[model samples]
Target: MNLEELLKSIIHQENELYNLYKLGETFATYELPSMVEHFKWLAGEELRHKRTIESFLEEDTLKGTAVIDYLDSLSLEPYFKDERAEPADLEDLILEALIREKHSYELYDRLSQILSGSLSDIFKMMRQEELKHAYRLKILYEMIGE
Candidate 1:
């Protein structure tokens, strides 16, 4: 896949994670109130990231090869088999999210360096947001004594 297609696929995977997190929040039977709140907030932030990526695409003035199909095929569930099989404890979940965010940040950062113009800016912003998410997850993990 080309750069645009790869970026779109990343965004699509983020969207899937956003939805999964939302569902996880709804289904979670957290023993601690703070843990419940943390997951809910994380889910919201994931959705916010999804919206940010969508907005960036809308604002992209330069048209490139559209790759909606490739994006549509991506899923986040299979990436975390342990979490998918049995829901992790709050700290474990946060750490898992942090790892995912780190991977995404690295991917986007590499893409940003290779790309130029608005596309580069979009990837940079995405990488920044992923890092922010990772930071938040780390904080939450520490708070939960993980």
Candidate 2:
């Protein structure tokens, strides 16, 4: 779990989140009109995050193997729990998305604490975005009377 490995894992997790939000968008398109744009925006944000993480791989600063232990100890399972095959309940989806956003925020916050310089800055920004997503999800939940 070198820097490249860590970054690839982050990119993969971001892709999973992107898929989750895209599913949310699809479900919202048919069931919750007011939430359609919000889901789309979230999916777009995840894509952007993925691209940013991918960009790190091309940089020469990814030569460290010291972070391997931390990467190995990190659990991305919470962020990967998107039950795509489940029934399309808007409320349930939003709740799950909220949970995922919270987990993402926690992960990014921890990473920002452990890493310094550009990596720290990126994780901090990502953590903020996840917080925004959680806040918006809460508002959406209330708007839908859930």
Candidate 3:
């Protein structure tokens, strides 16, 4: 509700996302050709997001009111959709990645609307990055599906 509480909640979610991506990279590295680089890159993005979120707590210039329970309405289904899934092929892997990116993108976009000023700008940037990730996954999925 207040700044501290909001930051704690956001930081927790960001850390969860970061860990998920890190786990994804770890699994990707075990593949034959190895998807280490791609997953690693995405994981790095998530790490950056985590750091960015932490900064908001300390950034006085950008400190506006944070929307408490902002993510309460957002479905966690897509983010966890393939958690127990084992990818049968590269296409499957790409589909799972796409789901993750799309969910993150949607969250950022919605949060941006609820945020104001510089914080909104940051969320918008994150949303665009996630969109790019989704596009990349789509291309990979198409290529592997053929």
Candidate 4:
């Protein structure tokens, strides 16, 4: 894909993720009250990601040949995972969110490798944020399971 296409695709994915997290937040509000705030935070983060990717469409630097080459070569298959079922319980909900976060982290990790300079650094930072999200979810899971 070209630079514009890639950015649009990423923005779409981010919006989808934001919806997923929002769903989780809604579910948690009644069934898993302890997790409501966490899900809200995750949803906000996803919205931020969507906006950031959208901003890339206006940046001339992202249209460079090297960036386009990386975009064309990037495999987005793993970035699009299967639709998650409604969680039956708190554990299920947390696991679903954790899995999505891990998937995002892996995608950013690979993007960081293929892109150059500041773009690579941006992905790296996003990857780290994903990792941190996963870690926080894991901790919450352990705490609630106790």
Q: lDDT values of the candidates?
A: 0.60, 0.77, 0.66, 0.77
lDDT of 4: 0.77
Q: For candidate 1, what is the TM-score?
A: 0.64
* Tens-place lDDT digits, model 3, residues 7-30: 555566556556655565665556
Candidate 3 residue-wise lDDT at 64: 40
Relative to the true structure, candidate 3 reaches a TM of 0.66
Return the lDDT, model 1, position 98.
65
| TM-score of each model, paired residue for residue | 0.64, 0.82, 0.66, 0.83
- Pairs clashing within candidate 1: none
Among all windows of ten consecutive residues in candidate 4, which has the lowest summed lDDT?
Answer: 64-73
For model 1, the superposed segments whose C-alpha errors exceed 4 Å read 2-8, 23-29, 52-86
- The per-residue C-alpha lDDT of model 4 at residue 73 equals 59
Worst 10 residues of 3 by lDDT: 76-85
lDDT of 4 by residue, 43-68 (tens): 89889888877877876547654666
Put down candidate 2 lDDT per residue, 1-146, tens digits, no spaces: 46676677677778877887888888888887878899899999989988987877777444563344477666756654444434358787778778778878987887777778887888899999999989988998897885
